[model samples]
Target: MATEYAFDIASDLKTVQALELLSRHISGLTLTWNGKNRDYLVGSTINISVSEQLRSWQETILEGFGFTPTLSVGFRFHNNTDFDAFSEIMFQATMLLLEHAEDAVLLFNYEIIVLQRLGGKLVFNAGYQMWDDDWLKSRLSLPFERRPLPSPLL
Candidate 1:
């Protein structure tokens, strides 16, 4: 078993148009807008958590890639596996991000301290109680924030 059913990608989408590129590649993917962001032509994030699981009988596919950055990124993923599936996805997601930024440093933190299931019972169980206790927050790209300042009154 592995960790995670969803993945979120962040990058500058102006020249790369990352969302469009990824949308074409990922299966069972959808592009959503929250109507809360107003940054144009700079940064875009794509969330891609899938319900599919990679069967243990199959070999783990390693992309052999990622980045070397130094920024703080905080994110939590769902733990959907009974074994190391969660850890494997952690590596996979790192590679996925590496494919985009090519220069980031991802550290696991506030992890495992993290989802969803449906049934008539609607039961919930949480493992890795202290998941993020250590931490692996990453620095994907250069630290960047888009903020519009007010004009001065003359």
Candidate 2:
């Protein structure tokens, strides 16, 4: 069974600056053309299988000054197989982002769902407890807050 967890990290820098910081600190970070919209872009870090779409208010004061950077990232891992490896990737990526930002917020995006195979069918169970011991928490000494995902899961 596979489970997915998502989170957001907002930074105090502009979109360009945040991208630059991530490019410098994050390994295997790449810019991919957004196939749906040519003008838009997506960023991915190979280590954790995390992808981010950064956006800011369209007002010139915000986009021009590069003062507001909102980043949305997610991780999908198999509960029975890839949890530890992917979770570790998530931790490392989070650490790198926070290190380069002046301010950041990590928002819990969805109920951690544990899936199990039952007679060839998959069942979903709330697994939020799994998050309490997540390695990302262990890496950050500062207190962090959790908030709902920006959008509900499908």
Candidate 3:
């Protein structure tokens, strides 16, 4: 079986705004909209989608984290590819969303990767064992705070 890699973020940003922001900041990806769903094809390898609604359990979990999510952005990876490049894009995308949304939480493979609240403060997690922000920062090379990335209009 192929290893499954997925990331989901529950955020207060509207679907349109999320799509727009992602399309602008993350380069070399194109988003095609169909009704409420937006699909991003990453070099014919990974398929990404935006979900406007959340399941009851998802909502409950977000609330437990002190977040009131309005919509969810989900990325589903179906095939193997250049994982390093994929990770970079995912990191950039997560930062972009967290920067713009007031309350947002990201889940990787159904595990909480990181979360932001009150518009600025961010919390990082590595499963239930490790909760060190430094570890996460070094692993992903992620900045402790938000920073601007070059945006190429989509």
The RMSD of every model to the true structure, in order and in angstroms, is 18.9, 11.6, 8.5
After TM-score superposition, the amount by which residue 76's alpha carbon in candidate 3 deviates from its true location, in angstroms, is 2.2
Selected candidate, larger TM-score, 1 vs 3: 3
Tens digits of per-residue lDDT for model 3 on 23-56? 8887777778765455443434445566665677
TM-scores, all models, native as reference: 0.31, 0.41, 0.65
Q: Where does model 3 exceed 4 Å of error?
A: 1-12, 36-45, 55-58, 112-119, 126-154
User: Evaluated with lDDT, which candidate comes out highest?
Assistant: 3
* Superposition TM-score, candidate 2 onto the true structure: 0.41
Candidate 1 stretches with Cα past 4 Å from truth are: 1-16, 38-75, 79-93, 110-154
lDDT of 2 by residue, 4-108 (tens): 444344445444554455556655445443444221122331222323443432132133222333554455553445555555555555566665444332323
Clashing pairs in 3: none
Ordered by TM-score, highest first, the candidates read 3, 2, 1
**What's the alpha carbon RMSD for model 3?**
8.5
Worst 10 residues of 1 by lDDT: 115-124
